[model samples]
Target chain A: MNIFASLSRKPWIWSFVAAFVVWIATILFTGGTSAIGLSQAALTFAAFSILVGIGQMFVITLGPGNIDLCVPATMTLAGTIALKFMQVDNSLILPGLVVAVAIGAVVGMGNFALIKLLQIPPIIATLSMSFIVQSTAIWTNRGLRIKPPQALAKFTTETTIGIPHVALVALVLSVFAFILLQKTVYGRWIAAIGQSNRAARMAGIPVDGTRFVTYILCAVLAAFCGYLLASFSGGAALNMGSEYLLMSIAVVVIGGTAVAGGNSNVAGIWGASLFMFLVVSMLNTYGAGAGIRLIMTGLIIIAVIVAAGGRNPNQR
Target chain B: MKRALPSDSIRLLIPALSLTILLIAVFYLQPRAMSYVGLNLLFNLAVPIALATIAQMLIMTVNDLDLSMGTFVSFVACVAATFLQATPVIGVLILVAAIATYAALGVLIHVRTLPSIVVTLGMSFVWGGLAVLILPAPGGHAPEWARAVMISRPPLVPMAIIACVVIAMVAHFVIMRSSIGVILRGVGGNARSVERAGWSILGARAATYALAAFFAILAGISLVGLTTSADANIALRYTLLSIAGVILGGGEFTGGRVSPIGAVIGALTLTLAGSFLSFLRISPDWQIGAQGAILIVVLGLRLLLNRLENREKRS
Candidate 1:
């Protein structure tokens, strides 16, 4: 494909360019090796968002106006629960993972029930679920401190081929997501449903069931991200998952995933997540306060929304 | 394809029943809550939440969600607490500007067909960042006159309850009883039809959002008056709280089917539920979950009612 054709077809290209531009900007500001160091650290730290962003991208792919707001709370719940179970014995790490994932599934089920049975809107259904899940996290743990298992922590921290294990895990997940979305019948179903759910239903697709599975998949991924992040950070806190609430959605949007749904860009999510992380890091390095950083992030999100052509006549 | 009466009544009935049940439960659980002081304490925070819910309801009337409502309210409170204290003129100008910005956002949303969620989500950070920049910390006194008006007591009714009643009445009259209200609801129910009828959909949406901003600023001012100080995060929870309030009150996302009185009642129900849980000595951690549980169960029951009503109609 020619450059214009590819640019028009591949939405992720924008994120790739944005990430590159930000990287260059960082290098110009910080001088060479230091910028590299910042990039390495940001990439490693951004793995969690990458995982969450990809999951969000999948759900958004399911349809326009569909979203999952429970990811943040689910992640927090999973992180705290994982630490709680693992604190007793490092040998219980596998069990801990299972429990966290189970909890996430349960939350997803609750969201599905609300959205499907009650016919509640996705935002409200998941938001209400988040409140419930977050409350459970707070009630059960009461802000207790528990250490992550030593082995897992070491794996997350250690570098192989100069890349962190967590980052590698994220990369593997991205590849898997790419293949799943680009090469599978399920991906085609999602695309069709996203374009027109009524039409897809008329065509014999199991629209509701597919959406149910997508929600569950999204939640599970978030739970896994939480587990990795908690272990890397040594522990978890109440607000640990708060930032992800908006960041996940922002990354998916910035990564070139259509907000109205029907498209998936796992690679774009990866690049967008890194770009977001670097934006924050760059602001921090410049001694910018939290307020300024927040303002910049908000502005960037708005800019991306406009660039995405939210009012595309075809979709409307 | 007839719009049956039973289903519509059932929709209204559920919220009314839920509010009654909640009120009875709260009173049964805590008998002393019947007194004037008890009522005052129970409803001290309800005014701002109710106001915010009204704001949310207006936007929903236009089929848009204002994700930034909480931060925008907090931003107003920051202005009330700081700039209003330092110089009244500049503070007033800033607020007017913010409301105008909200109107501009409505135009942008309508023109670009951007999802309100994305635009408001992005604006949330902008509003929150502005609030943080204004106060930097949580310490700022509300202007004296505003505080006086907020704290003033009326005979026979608690000030909070009175404020809630007045707000509900005015909003109900404006949005439900007036011709403009009909036009606004028309836009939400069927924008194409409204546009075909030659009504300026853009103007209606912009006006609706401006009204939302107006109510949000009022909520912020009231909040500041009550709390006596403001911070960027003070009203952060109001976003979800207001959404819950509107939904509990019988508002739908796509329809202009919202009730002003129901919104106030819903806000009160939630407030009372929270107070009752605290009275029961449930941990703060559990209180949020309990509220969410209440919301789900109530909404679930409404769903069941709707299905049954529909089935009956079909039969």
Candidate 2:
């Protein structure tokens, strides 16, 4: 009864219901004609969306001001770094992953420092940092494309049984992140600080450090997703990360995570990710190109935000 | 009795200093870059963005963002270009109609009390899509007379500079003298308090957004003149640039304060910066990176100055 009540209380459950309806509509319309192909596409997009959503959730649940504009750039920079490293030496695959994650951490730390030291508003600071990171990525790439490494490519493509590799990776990461957020002391601190930094500080929580770590963790995860993205897309482009910005925020909102921080629903986030993918896939299947797809996506996000209310209770 | 300078006065001074420093840097680096012709070009480039930034600043002062300004601008430009291809008068009518329609939409969203960011962003996408539909490949041209009027300079000074000054003065008047302006600042500072005072938050927000759309339309027309042709992609850069300008000009995104003149000056600074980079023959990619870097640095410096001022006052 308690579990059911909790599930019912989850805001993202409503989003999931919406997603399920769309999934059913998609399946009915397609009539199993391209079931395997549809599933593959859906899985890949869902995984990518989930990873990005997870990163957003962390920042939304942490930060003095509950907003993050650096997710896309951080992800892109990480991907760019990973790709560049892999291109130079095939033996540096593991090192490349570490370096990519580290780059994300550095970017997050940079934002954290700015917010803490300079007292720049969170949204503005993150936004400016995002621009910087994006520019850096563009500059590093020298207005050219960087191909994905072969080993990483194989890892992302190789699947076991019926499940896709990307989906599996997403699942593992989500579960791990969920556990980290729910069961750990740091998780409790995150929630506490998010609720009231003053109270958290009174309770002896390292508020600034926690926020810094949260941002770093978020950036690292986003970067990891970017790596996965590069592997899937086979190459990294300059504006590759920009698309993820809105999608990630939308997923977080749909997943029942408020932008103001404190509350989070990992399961709901995963469901939202799946729902977003299903919607996009359905739209694409119906012959909607990039422009239409973008418009529809924007509309759906707006609708969801309206339904959820303008201010998230958890937001600072 | 001793009194500290008003916040507004300090706000004005910062932008003035920033602009002066920017001009000095440009002149020092390249002495010949300060020609009348070059200044005219800079004014032309800054005017549209300055108008858009003013619009953005109004919304931001109310603690709202208008992400759709660029798209709205593009849509209006496309409409004006298509309907007024041969007649400048028709183009003016189309522009007014477009602005009115967008303002009505703004009112609708405000009345609903929806999140401005999400609503405007969605609206922008819809408008952008419509623009693409209107001019699929960007071949249609604005009437030659209209274009000439938009880009032409007066005998004594550039028309663009005059437009900037006139618009800034009008905006300053509207923001400082009007009851609606006071109400906007009040609402931006604290909506709950304003509501408690029996004021309609929606009314204030709607008016600001409508004003923003009006400016956006004017900007769109100017952009059409600059490019000669209506392209769907023309206004995309304006979205970020306007916000950057507003912030750099000491306009807070969360409602309460605005500096229209500051915003214009910020726009001018951005234009000058871009031109200076172009003069150095920097690639497009490098230019973007440099612009981003400069904005971040400027914002950082602004924050540092604000902190110091606050501390000094406290002391």
Candidate 1 residue lDDT tens string, A1-316: 5978766667777777777777787777777768757767878978989998888888888876588989988998999998898884779889989988898788888889889988887877888888899899897678786789898788878888878888999999999888888898887888889888999999999999889988988999999988888888888777788889888988887787777778667878887888888877777777889889888877777877777655344653
How many clashes in each structure? 1, 6
- Cα lDDT tens digits for candidate 2, B92-177: 67666666665665665565555565567667777787788777777678767668888776787778778888878888888877
TM-scores of all candidate predictions against the true structure: 0.95, 0.91
Top-TM-score candidate index: 1
Cα miss at B148, model 2 (Å)? Answer: 3.1
Give the alpha carbon lDDT tens digit for every residue of B76-110 in model 1.
Answer: 99999998878999999999998899999999989
- Superposed by TM-score, candidate 1 places the C-alpha of residue A37 at a distance from the truth, in angstroms, of 1.3
TM-score of 2: 0.91
* Candidate 2 CAPRI grade: acceptable
Per-model root-mean-square deviation over C-alphas: 2.4, 3.1
Candidate 2's C-alpha runs over 4 A off are A1-8, A63-66, A88-90, A289-292, A310-316, B1-3, B84-113, B143-146, B280-285
